[model samples]
Target: MFRPENAQSLVGLALTLLVCWLLSENRRAFPWRLTLGAVAVQVGLVLLLFGTPGAQTVVSGVNDAVDGLAAATARGTQFVFGYMGGGDQPYQVTNAGALFVFAFQVLPLILVISALSALLWHWKILKWITQGFGLLFQRTMGLGGASALAVAVNIFLGMIESPIVIRAYLDKLTRSELFLMIVVGLATVAGSTMVAYATILKAVLPNAAAHVLVASIVSAPAGVLLARIVVPEKPGQGGYYADYGSLLKYDSAIDAISKGTMDGLTVVLNISAILIVFVAFVAIGNSLLSIFPPVLGQPVTIERILGAVFSPLAWTLGIDWKEAHEAGYLLGVKLMLTEFIAFIQLGAVPEGAMSERTRMIMTYALCGFANIGSVGITVSGMGVLMPDRRTEIIGMVWKALVAGFLATCMTASIVGAMPRELFGY
Candidate 1:
């Protein structure tokens, strides 16, 4: 089994950091302490959660709750769509295999989790957790209070929704702080979406829920650390803002849940539409590629092209060379499309296509929301919240995407370096 103390893992860690450093906008001013601290924190948390029996039990409990939520979603879908939606039926049929109908089985959990998150936010439970995390970032990373709070909130809320928490300070934020927010937002998946992903990945990875939760938690600080390197803060420019007040509010518990459900419906519909369109596009692209001369008795396609291009990067993240191309293909899919699409494809991967260790690394690597489509969404959503900074946000979009990509890869490399025995592999 792989161990963290090995030379190969150390080389992987060094190469990961080196790539981030080489991409730094201001190498001289890069925040080494923040980067090192973020790595230490991530490794520490992973060991505590994966190596310790007590923490593993807690993670298992959370996974159980996720399973329960998934089951409840099935019940709701079954009630509406009958047997096609996973309900009991008198005779066997292929209706359950329909893409449109299958979406109902998994996507409804987004509604439930989103509504539950809103209710918790309204009750200030999420606020307390956000504040606690914010303070840690403020103290450790030297981030302003508003920036730290926004980054922390990104763990639970969507990228666009998180900025609303620090709305008042958006314009006043320093360049580095603003970019950090964007990078963190792109780097981490929202909690509601995380549950949906966990459900999708449950078959191949039994501990998918725990891994998704840990990936989000680690990526926040890691994103900030990487963002600072890419766009280092100017001296005497960043400080905690104590006056940013709460922007999320509700009339009552019912109101919170109602609005959350409506918002989730929008997300669900958006995802369904995107999947339909993107999948069709990929198929069309592959058809065009099929006209090319065969390679190894198979027609060249987008996946193979992506694999050839990004396989080296995947190998640097500690994926085995033999499986690096497959992992790279998934990574490319994530960058070109969305993590949701990439994960759905991952779920469909044939057994023996990649080793279990490589799958775990890919899971963490592709956990972010950084993709070409997300750039437009971030710009439009953040534009609505802070119109004055729309131009700046647009300019920073590509850079933020790169930073977010590196951050997720950084997390994956760190996880890959950890001893496999710790995960009982």
Candidate 2:
């Protein structure tokens, strides 16, 4: 028998594609070949990732490695920051939850992972993987050399950093290709943040490392699929820049470590500031909203407003109508704020408030960096890379954000389509 959630997800998938086409700049120019190719690639990848035995073993090993890395980070943090950072407590803990400090414990993983990512780039480990995927995308999806490379690299890098890998082709990329890069970049999380995200979700979701990794990898094609639909390429409009491999490099391992650590420090500081400022603003907004009368027996807070607006979108992702309002609130927070904030809030939700399956679906849906603030970050980053195309960048970015956001939803719907048996539920 066909599962009810799977049926819902299939419908959600169709609705997602329909919505993408409805917003297309040139619907007649839709690249059906790329569409089919991207979907096939995504399906094959997801199956290979979830169904294959050997792949599962590898994923398990990866999870173990991530745990090791997290442990190593804890060691480093404890030494630097004392017992507050997971070191031995000078006094007996009254409560386990009360003793855990997010800033001291979890945020430090960003520093360790960033430095390791830089070291891997220096060793060409990341470059080789990016090349293999880039070639696959270029051949299967008919993407330009630069677009293929950028999207593949984006699986492991940030929105702006991926473009840096294809810096040589930034100016030459067609408008469609440029937009695709941004969408894919926003659709996936960076490698540096993957472990940190896994750490956050590990308590709530088993095998969180693999889920985040698969979400980033699988969402690449979903981003491409939606981006192409929303802004289909016209023949003879842009040059075909094929893959030339990664141009990103560091002078040496030591240089990589230093640069990576500094980069991590920037992210750490930014996350701190963002959480502090955004949380306060949200509290202020909620306080202001309190003046209004309650609606439908609930206070009209920002989250409730967002939940009402996005509940339909959440429902379309195979979420139950009854639970969708809660899921919608999370999605709204993700789009309006950031995924970091979303994940934190998700971790805080009570156990029985949402099902384990719903949590998994939400995990994939909220994996990306697409949000209101990221538009400015992306445009400014892309603008710095290609100053002359700033106008085009500005024009296409908001649309790309929409595509990016929907791409993650598309990924979630596909995941929801699968039997819960595959996930050991």
Candidate 3:
């Protein structure tokens, strides 16, 4: 069995916590119980999911399910886009270049998954799962009911959609609790996007689905722990729980799917627009940077700048020093742009450019929605949900983004600390 990279993992974990501590509003009253408990929970999950045969079987099942889902999406695409959606063409070209049609493949999955999630919610299956986990968060971390529920549901729902579960309690939540909610939102990826990411990275990492699921689970508690450390709960503000009965309801099963499809379309369009604009901006920035001077006989670009800036952090996460810069570039891309772009770029990383270990570390690290753009989404979405908390939400966005970033890194460290045997290395 391959041994854990214990030294690097320890440094990563310490550095992640230290960064959170440095940014803490009240270092003296740090929630040690919550912090330690969250770490225990993350470690337990990593061992159970990565080291056990039974859990591996379940992960395989999820992978199989995702494959089926992807196939279904392909059928729908074939019906609409014809051969462009992977259907057979009348004649094949002698040397056809690969096409990157975002509309035909990537965006459609979002709509399908969103609709399925809505159907599950309508059946109350999602409610049970969310509530069960919410209760666990409440008991283990001593979180108020509303905050715990919001964090728990976030595993399945998007950040903005999750707050709707505790909408009744949003205005009443303490500043600390509200901030925790925002951090949880940024820390975890939604189910729809999670599957999309898994599909994108499937070629590079065969077990992408399992890792994404584990990342979401581990980050929830990590976010809570970091949020508590950064801004401790005030005196006389504990044990408050929102009634589960206050959840929003759908008109019917059909309504749920239809509404979900519509919502997913909006998300699809937003993602397309964001990618087009942000990617163009990056290209523009790189063009300008390239004019300055050459670096090591090559023109300086945005990727090189990001890699140089974040290489040390990547090394702490158990990436080999030689390959850390490349890994760091992916992390920086995720933070500056989006995880979707980062994953796409990751899959396209030339063979032998980095070791498999480095690729795995970057995959775990970048599996979050903590980009700069998400700050505006969280602030505005929560602002509309609870108009009174708009000012508070805006104030907490930067800190929440930092906490979310640290939380994902914490997950990476825990995974890195696992014996390579767990990853079949």
Candidate 4:
């Protein structure tokens, strides 16, 4: 079932690693053991997650839960904002698609999921899970206690939020360890935003929530692998640090909900604000470019420009050249702008613009916090906690950004190279 064409993605995989090595501070020393282990771990995750029938069922359950959560979030929105919030419309419906309002309906899911995650954290469900992953990283990948914990936490939390859990360990980490933590953070998406993204692309990509989870988990080792290559630990640098396991504390269940909702609200506002600004910029930029002649029979808008620029890279993800333009645009938007906007555009991609397989690959590739904007966000967030290392953090962000970008790229290629039957597309 492995198409010969998929081999191109393997080339992509090799090239991605090579680029990381090329950018290495210590080119003479590559962590070959760590690199091989990392790739195997990603393949293992894809197999365990998608190759089994039981795991397929789990994927279904997760999708169902996301639908239910979206429904629940809708109820809250309707109660507060009336029909505009996806409640009954007073006017005769000419177009149902018009009724699917993103601001009113989709974005609100963040608030609910955020609160639930907080509640789970208070209950120690998430904590136990994080610790389990930390143990796995420490054992399998040779990560330090705090570094492993930070990487594990990033699977479920945001860049800054994950680092906050191991705040005490931030200053204590070696250069290589700290950079790994940042790259891992950039390479993964926050659990709080996962549902919102699931809702956005559920129509285009099957079991979208599950794939998002898959992308997040697999990117961990990829991040670790790339981080180590770019900044190899000192020859004698052994990963050891204090146990920062129970650092994310809360007063009670009620306190957790309150804190979580407030945090979600911050995310919600930040998202809303960014969308407005970015969309406006896109509009302005497109308007200015309207005077330019069309290329390939399409207008020279920002989207088309982005697609043209990123097509080759998207091709590396095993997307067909014919479909690469569309995939590239989304990839470009993700790296240059934000994943949220990219998801919105991907959801709106006209049917047949790209194959379902290409869409799935893009979903995996886009499932990260690696973008120009996030580099600054991660730097600032980590800097606030350890202001003394602000300069050092700033210096390493560029390397981490490239590592994070390539980390997600590696995940896509791995998934792309596998037989569709293996994952049951």
Candidate 5:
């Protein structure tokens, strides 16, 4: 099954690692052991979640929740369009396929999941779970305590919310630790987005939530390795919180829902604004490209160029060559534009343009905000949270962004290449 495309993808990943190392401020002093340990722990987590029946049940329950949301969206679509959303209307749909163009179209799951997650946190369920994971990271990966919490919270919460959990110590984090946080946040998607992603990729990829969920979980360690290489941890680094109790504070269920909904609203608004401009720009670019038609030379579009450039990388993740380029185009758009924009485009890919495996891998790869714009946001947001360390945050932005992008790529490669049965597909 291994082919030239696979080799190309591997080479691309290797090149990314090289790029990370070359860009590091102190690559010479990188902590190799710690990096390897983090990778090992991540691999183990993936195995436990997917391999064991009991663990799979829990994860599957989460997946079921996302699936239910998708189904509900279909119903809501019907309610809004008066049977048109029920597959009755073939040609006329909104900008991104107006299935149910409303506030809750596919994003309500974020509110639901956020509320539930907050409840779990209030009940100490997530706290206990993350504590064990955190202990392993501390003992094995040798990561700073606050950074570990950020990574775990990233698996559950939005980037902005996760960092606030450690707000008290933000000003004290080291350069390497802060970089790791930024990379992890950018590499992983928030739980609220799972339903939207599932809805977009479900037609082409089986077990969409499973793949996306696993991708975020696995990206943590990959982010750690890349971040460390970019700015090696100071051997005797101090000022990291080691105790868990101080950081784990939970309000009641009502408070959780209220706060969680507000958080989801911010995400929704951000997605809306970003998409309006990004799509406009893409349309403009396409219009410009349309001038040079097949009459003079073959028609060229932004998607086509991206597909050609990233197709090899896509194939390395076990995607068939026939569909690799389309998948690659999606990845390129996700990285350069925004994940929401990419997901919308993904839903509209011509029938049979991408294979199941390729679509699945692209979904995982494009789950987070690993683009250049996110780098600026993270640096600004986290810098303000830690005003004393603004300079350090600025220093690590570029490296963290690159690391985050590569981490998602690495996660896709491993998960996509593995046995499909692992995803219950």
Candidate 6:
């Protein structure tokens, strides 16, 4: 029998489609075929990983790499926060009960990981991986080579920096191509951000890095589909031309490591500031809601209100109603606010706030960069790299935002639909 949670996930999927209908600028002209194609890519990811041993072994290998990295992060966390990095067991007194210190702690890992990843790329490991994926994207989605490289690299690099891969092509990209770039940038999490998010989600999900890595990999093709639909592909578009032969002239090994470290620091600082403001906002919103009449003898908060509003959708996405409201509220917040804040809230959920299934479902759901703020970030960052095409970048922001959200939701649905056996449950 299909679990109620499975049925609920489908319901959430339907609601997401409804949201797309309501928000799309030209609803009558929406490219349903490409939208469905994006969803199909997500489904394929789940099936290949879960249904076949060969595929599972491949995914498991990737998962092991992620796990190894995450374990390193945990040890680093232990060094910084002591036992607070682990559990609340006795004989373990923690340094700071405050949240700010908690967030600041272990942030150094971002720098370490960033520097290491740059070294890996400098050695051509990540470049080959990204190019291989880019080639596959070009074949399947029929995207331009330059655009495919940018999107694939964005999966492993920050939004601002990924466009540098195709610096020569940026200034010459067409309007539709520019839109695709923005959409892909806004839809996927960069590699540096993934480590930060893993720290946040680790408290809720057992294998957070594995889930995050998978989410980004799966979202890549979805981003391609959505971008193509947002601005239908133009025929006779010139293909991408690369100057990688002289990439070392752009940066030596030491230069790449230093540059990556600086970029990661900026990202870490931005994250710190955003978390401070969002947490305060959540507290204030919840405080105001507490003035309302009690429901079931409990004062209401924004989390509960969000739960009430999004619970049905959550149920449809394969989460038990017992845990649906909390998960649903996070999804709504992720869409309306930012994925970073939603992830923080997800981590802080009180024990018993969600079931194991709900936590697993949400780990995939809240894995994108689809909030309104990212729309602006994508435009500005890409605009700087391709100043001549600023108008085209501006035009695609809204469409990219909408399409990116749908692509992430498509991922959530696919993961939710897979049989428990596939997940070894």
- Using lDDT as the measure, the top candidate is 4
TM-scores, one per candidate: 0.95, 0.97, 0.97, 0.97, 0.85, 0.83
- Residue 42 of model 3, lDDT score: 87
lDDT of 6 by residue, 112-200 (tens): 67876787788788888888877767766666788878777878875666677778777767766777777677678888778777777
lDDT of candidate 5 at residue 58, scale 0 to 100: 71
Stretches > 4 Å off in candidate 6:
1-8, 11-40, 54-64, 70-101, 238-250, 288-297, 350-352
- lDDT at 367, model 2: 94
Alpha-carbon lDDT, every model: 0.84, 0.87, 0.85, 0.88, 0.72, 0.71
lDDT of candidate 5 over 1-425, digit per residue (tens): 44454555555556557778888887677666865676576667677777776876777786787777667656755666554455466665565445555454565555556666777777778878777766666677777788888777877776776778888777677767777788888988777776677776666666667767777777777787778888787768843775667764656778876876776767777777777888798889989989776533567888888888987767766677777787788878888898877877776676477556566667767878788667777877777787777787787677677788888887776565456566564
- TM-score of predicted model 1? 0.95
Any idea what lDDT model 5 has? 0.72
* Candidate 6 clashes between residue pairs 3 or more apart in a chain or in different chains: 5-318, 8-315, 8-316, 8-317, 9-316, 9-317, 9-318
lDDT, candidate 2, 1-425, per-residue tens: 35888888877788878988998998887777877787788778877877788877867887898899999998899899998887888998889888789999889999988899899989989888888888888888877777888888899878888888888777778778888998998899888888888888888887788888988898999999999899888777654565454377899999999999999998899888888888888999999999999998988899999899999989889899998999999999999999999999888887788888898899999999999878989988888889999999899888899999999999998888888877767
Tell me how far the alpha carbon of residue 201 in candidate 1 is from the true structure, in angstroms, after superposition: 1.0
Over 4 Å off, model 4: 242-245
The sequence of per-residue lDDT tens digits that candidate 4 reaches over residues 182-201 is 99999999888989888988
Candidate order by lDDT, decreasing, is 4, 2, 3, 1, 5, 6
Which window of 10 residues has the lowest lDDT sum in candidate 2? Answer: 237-246
Clashes of 6: 7
lDDT of 3 by residue, 1-425 (tens): 43546568778988988888988998888777887899888888778877776877987998888889999999999899887886777686564545446678778999999999898988989888888989988888888888888998899988989888777777688888888888988888888888888888777786888877788888899889888888888888855677876586789999999998988888899889998998999999998997787989888999999999988998899888888898889889999999889988888887568666777777788888899999999988988998877887888899999999888888888788777767766
Ten residues in sequence with the least summed lDDT for candidate 6: 241-250
Cα RMSD to the true fold for all candidates: 2.0, 1.5, 1.5, 1.3, 3.9, 3.9
